[model samples]
Target: MASGTGSTEDRSYTERLTRLGGARWKQVLDVQAPYRWNLRRHLGGRTVLDVGCGIGRNLQHLDPSSVGVDHNAESVGLCREAGLRAITTDELESSEEMIPGRFDALLAAHLLEHLPEGAAADVLRPYLRFLAPGARLVFICPQQRGFRSDATHTVYFDDDLLARTMREIGGEVVDQSSFPFPRAAGPWFTYNEFVTVGRLADRR
Candidate 1:
């Protein structure tokens, strides 16, 4: 799955993406999206916090109790418009009451590469507090070619870097691997992802 479908947060992107992933179109695409259905099954009944959830793409397959958070107000509006539960990053940070509860899992799919190393750490630490002890943390970042595809992406993560980043944030790495396909796929949408699965080590 792709991260910010639009690099910038603006109504212009909202207007464009709305047409691109509008109701009718989403209905057809959601069912066909790869890996998400199995991901739903893997999640079982756990509630998830989807960080950087753009336009609620990942929300479609997660549990109904999942809450999506985005920095983009327009994207959050679009998610709410589609009857999905979501909140803005400002709202989430402005008050502790906004978080529904400790989530069983956290998803930051295709998100981390956008920030510098230190900024990424700063952004992730706060979210860890909202996770239940032993909660699973799943991180997906671009590999090589995919990293170059988006001009906004500032960093590239191989397996080691992803593991180190998670460990630095107090996560115990459980699995680290290149996903969906081999590295031959090139880092592009519908192809490669450096997937790291970890668990919060009772930090809360």
Candidate 2:
């Protein structure tokens, strides 16, 4: 069962994001390093807008010039506490970083799967205007095995699904790849993900 829009924005959802299996132990081991570096490799711009920033896991690894946005206020707060810039959806337009063509890239790590069929397009359309005409857009969605790990995931956004959603948002799909493993590994590896890169079509 998938969570409703409200449930995904709840504090409990944010709480679950913090369940990284003993924070101190995980930090000491730096288990997220490879994945963090993997994500960092995709973003090569000075400024990025990280939608669905979720506790700043991805945001923390991005450049300081990046700004994050999530519907979960608590997650936004936690991001700020960790010295990352983040804001809730409500503060988006008014945010100082919302200037036209303000960002060079946009990121939505593990975000689209949480949205139902048409929601990904709706969610991404508005943000495209804030990005430069040819700014990069990266949508990272979990593969089959990783999808089942979260009850909140509404739909699985595989390569085809992601390409469709990106087209709807006026983006040009440039590439798609299985990160840290081959496509075959997705169904068995919990963290295996599809990294889709798109360029916002020249809206000007």
Candidate 3:
């Protein structure tokens, strides 16, 4: 795990908005990519909490009961327009109140990089209280240098590091993989990306 406290407030208003817009496009394309196969594998019939669900694009891939949460008011409006259950909160800490009830799974895509190096785990710690035994948490983020190009990215986590960190938070790794974009892929392959799945440990 990388060290240093991350703060979205560190960026200027324009910079933050730019990052948000870029992410929206990236997510739209990503949702259609083959890499999303893992998401489908785990999402069926499960109630999901989509953190940072901009425009609720991913919601289209899930069932009607899934819920999305975003901190951006505009994105929240878009989510509603798209017919997703959504709420806008000021920060991750506010999610408990903004959307009540436990979730069977949590899906966070490229959202963890925005948090400070160790902060992602911190934010997820409390969500554990809302998960049932054997519930899963799935997350996707850039690998290595891929995390730096984004100005809003406060940290990076490789497969091993991310898996280890998740274990520390009472989740056990079930899967960890990547997906490279078309441009990044080698002559034979055409994309680069990664997805990880972990199951919450049984407390009793």
Candidate 4:
């Protein structure tokens, strides 16, 4: 199980993102534009909190008002260097960036898979307080091929598992989809993702 400390994972993860940043393919075709568009279309919030935002790739594509947090300090530093608002997990816990309930959306992408099954709720619980009662909850996890592509990924989350995680985090599951391809393509396509969206129920 990943400690979420990002200690052992820091160097490797950052190195990988650094390489992806300069990939020759990206220069030619913006291969990720469709995925970026898919993510942005779902985020209809002024203030977004991106959980486990590695190196702020999403931040660069998301609303500028959004903030990102990663367990890795190195990744956080890179984000800061890029002029994106990002912090480490420890910093976010003490950040004055927003008061409770100030955030309209919470995004956890490619994060849950790093933990074991049934562990998403625990990983996400600490970040929930920052979101508004009716905040949108978006959880994205890698499919089979993508899961296998990373040594750190421990689980492959399907729609049922993702919906369950959303519910555990006080979110009501609204919809889910396989991105850039159909469900059948997940086993073959390394970039396929399971995107689940939910809404937090109003507090009584």
What lDDT does model 3 reach? Answer: 0.67
Can you tell me which runs of candidate 3 are displaced by over 4 Å?
1-31, 90-101, 180-191
The residue pairs in collision within model 3 are 178-193, 178-194, 179-192, 179-193, 179-194, 180-191, 180-192, 180-193, 181-192
N/CA/C clash count, model 1? 1
All candidates' TM-scores? 0.82, 0.92, 0.73, 0.93
lDDT of 1: 0.75
TM-score of 1: 0.82
lDDT of 1 by residue, 21-135 (tens): 5568567766336567546644657898888887887777788888888888998998899788898888987655345346989888877887755577688887877788889
Stretches > 4 Å off in candidate 1:
1-7, 13-32, 93-101, 187-190
lDDT of each: 0.75, 0.86, 0.67, 0.84
**Over the stretch 1-204, how does candidate 2's per-residue lDDT look in tens digits?**
344343678888888888763489888988788788777788954589999999998898888999999999999999999999999999987888788898989998989888886788898888887898888889998898988888778888889988998888888899999988999999899989899998888877
Ranking by lDDT: 2, 4, 1, 3
lDDT per residue for candidate 4 within 1-204, as digits (tens), equals: 222323325678898878977799886998888988988899944589999899887878878888998888888898999999998888875787856887889999888888766778998988878888899989998888887777777767889989988888889998999998999998999989899999988875
Please tell me which predicted candidate would have the highest lDDT against the true structure.
Answer: 2
For residue 88, give model 1's deviation from the true position in Å: 0.5
Model 3: per-residue Cα lDDT over 1-204, one tens digit each: 353344444224324544654587777775455544656786777888887676665766776777777666776766777677887656545544334346778887767777756677777676566566778888877664555445566766667767877788888899776664432442234224457898888886
Q: Evaluate model 4: give its lDDT.
A: 0.84
